[model samples]
Target: MAVASNYLLDTGPLSILCSFPLNASPYIYAILQYTKITLADSVIIEAGRGKIWRIVSPLFKTGEIESTTTPKEPEILDLSYGNDLGLGERSTIKSAMQMGLTAIIDDRDAFVVANRFAVHPIGFQDWMVMLSREVNLPTKMAIEIVRSSANQFPKMFLAHILKLLSE
Candidate 1:
C-alpha cells in the first residue's frame, strides 16, 4: 500500500466538503485512500453541530478522521497576533507549522496567512486536482466533484481551476 500523505484540514476545506451531497462518504473515502486528514480540536468545535460535523462525526469514530489538540506553543501565540483568523484556521496553521505538514485551507485569507508563516497551503480546488493527478483518481470524476462545489469557490478561481483540470 502507498503511504498516505498527511494534511492538516482547516474548517474551510471541511465546509466545502460538507456542501457536497448528503453523505460525503465517496469523496471522503477517495481522499482517505492517499491522504491522512487531521483535524484540530478547534476545527471540530468550529464545525459544531452542522452538516459538516455530521459527515465527519462518523469518520472521527472510525478513525478515518484523526483528531488533534492545538498546542499552547509559541507558534499558536504568534498566529494569534498575526491575522484575524478564526480559532480553527489558527490552530490548523500552527499545527502545520510545528508538524511540517501541508494545510488544506480554501479560504483566500487563511491561505495567505499560512503562506506568510511558511506553512504550505493547498486550496481545496488544487487539492482535488492533486488527488486526481497524483493518486490516480479518475480525472472526470475529480472535475465533476469540483463542479459540484462550484458555488463555494470564487468565480475566477473556479474558472482557473477548471481550465487547469482541462489541461
Candidate 2:
C-alpha cells in the first residue's frame, strides 16, 4: 500500500529538530519527499531563525516545505479555545483540514480536535515507526535522538519511545 500523500507538521516536530543534535528525522524527510507536506505561515514563523530554520529553509527553497495561509473556519478556532493553542498549531491544523491532509501533532488536545474533524493526527512514536520501516535506523540511534531531544520532549513521551525501541 502507498503511504498517504499529505502531511502537516505542527511545531513539535520542528522543535525536535532544533533540540536534537542529530540531523532531521529520516522518516520525516522521507515523508516530505514522498508526500505533500504543508506548513502554515504561522508554523514557519514559530520555527524562527535557528538551527532548524537554517536546515529547513533550504528545503523550503527547494520546494519541500510548502507555505499556506490559515483556514477561516470559526469551528476550528472554537476547538482550540480550551487548550493554550498557539497560532502555529491552530493554523497548521486549519490548513490540514482545508487541504484534507493528515496533521502530525503531539499535543493531546490538538489530536482530539483533529480527530473530530476526521483528520488523521500522528504523534512522535508514529513517525518513528514509519522511519524504522523506511530506513535502517538502528534502535540505538533512535534512542540517542530521543534522549538528546529530552528538553523538547516530555519525559513520559521520551520514556515511551525508549520502551518501544527496546521492545
Candidate 3:
C-alpha cells in the first residue's frame, strides 16, 4: 500500500529509539511531532523488555505516543495465516491498516509482508534521513549515531547508507 505520513510503532524501531536522545527516540515521535502516532500493547511488551520500560514510559505519560487496543481476533488470525510474525509486528500492521498509518518496522521480512497488506513500512534509516533533513544534521552526526548504536547492525549496511547520504 501507499505509505501514509502518520505511523504506528513496532518493536525494533521503538527499541532503537529508546536508546536515542529522549532516552527513547522513536525519532518519528520527535520528528513528526504534529502527526499522530499509534502503538499497540504488544509493541509495548516487546519494547518493555529489559530496562526499556523505564525509558519508554515518559513518552506515553507526556502524550508522545498513543496506545492502541489489541486487534480483533479474526483480523489478527487473517493476518497470521500467510505469515509468521511477532505479535508486535502483527499488531503494528493491523493498527496501521485500521488507522491508515505507516508501520514503523525495521524487520525486512515483516516489512515486506506489511506492504502486501497495503500498509507502508518505515525503517530506521528512513527516520535517520528524516532527522537529518529536518534538523539539517551534519552527515558526520548521522553517521556517528548509526555506527555507535548498540544494535550493531553491520559495517557493509552502514557503509551503504552513509555513502547514499553522501551522494
Candidate 4:
C-alpha cells in the first residue's frame, strides 16, 4: 500500500491539521514520513486569514511542507463552474492533475469535482486510515486524531473508524 510520493492539500485538511501544536505536529510529521505534501500558494493565502496560518506557516518554514504557485490555467477555473468549490480546492485539484499527485481534499463537493476532472482524491478520514494500516501509525494516536477532528466526519463513519482502530 504505497501512498503517492506527493499530495496536494486543500484548505479543509489544512485547517483541521491546525488543531495540532506546531511544536509537536505529530500527524503531519507521521504523514511526511510516508509521503511528501505540497500546498497550493492559494491555500497559504486563504488559510492565512485564520489560526491555520499559525501552523501552516511554521511547517512551510521548517521544510516539513512545500508550497507551489497555482497554475492560472482555465481548466483550474473550469472546475469551479456551477459549484461552490473555492480557490484552494480548485488549485489543489489542478495541481494534482498536472503534477501526478493525489489531491488530499476533505470537502465532499471538492472530492466529487476532483474525480470529475480525473484527478485522484482522498478524504482526510481515509487518509488517516491509510496511515494507520500502511504506515503503522499507532492506534491510540490515530484514535485521538480522529476524535479531535470528529466534526468534519459523519457520525457513523467516525464510529466505524473508531471500531477499526480499536480492533
Instruction: Summarize candidate 4's per-residue lDDT along 53-95 as a digit string, tens digits.
Output: 7666777898878999887775635544536888888888778
Q: Which portions of model 1 miss their true places by more than 4 Å?
A: 1-3, 22-26, 75-83
lDDT tens digits, residues 73-127, model 3?
A: 4474454543678878877877777777667788777888788778878777765
Q: What lDDT tens digits, residue by residue, belong to model 1 across residues 82-156?
A: 457788988898788878888999777788878877888998899888877777656787787788888887788
Off by over 4 Å in 4: 1-4, 20-34, 74-76, 79-83
Error of 3 at 108 (Å): 2.2
Considering summed lDDT, which 10 consecutive residues are worst modelled in model 3? Answer: 22-31
Q: What is the lDDT of candidate 3?
A: 0.67
User: What ranges in model 3 sit over 4 Å off?
Assistant: 1-5, 20-37, 73-83, 134-141, 150-154
**So what's the TM-score on candidate 2?**
0.72
**After TM-score superposition, what is the CA distance of residue 128 in candidate 1 from its true location, in Å?**
0.8
lDDT winner between candidates 2 and 4:
4
**Models ranked on TM-score:** 1, 4, 3, 2
- Colliding pairs, model 4: none
> Which scores greater on TM-score, model 1 or model 4?
1
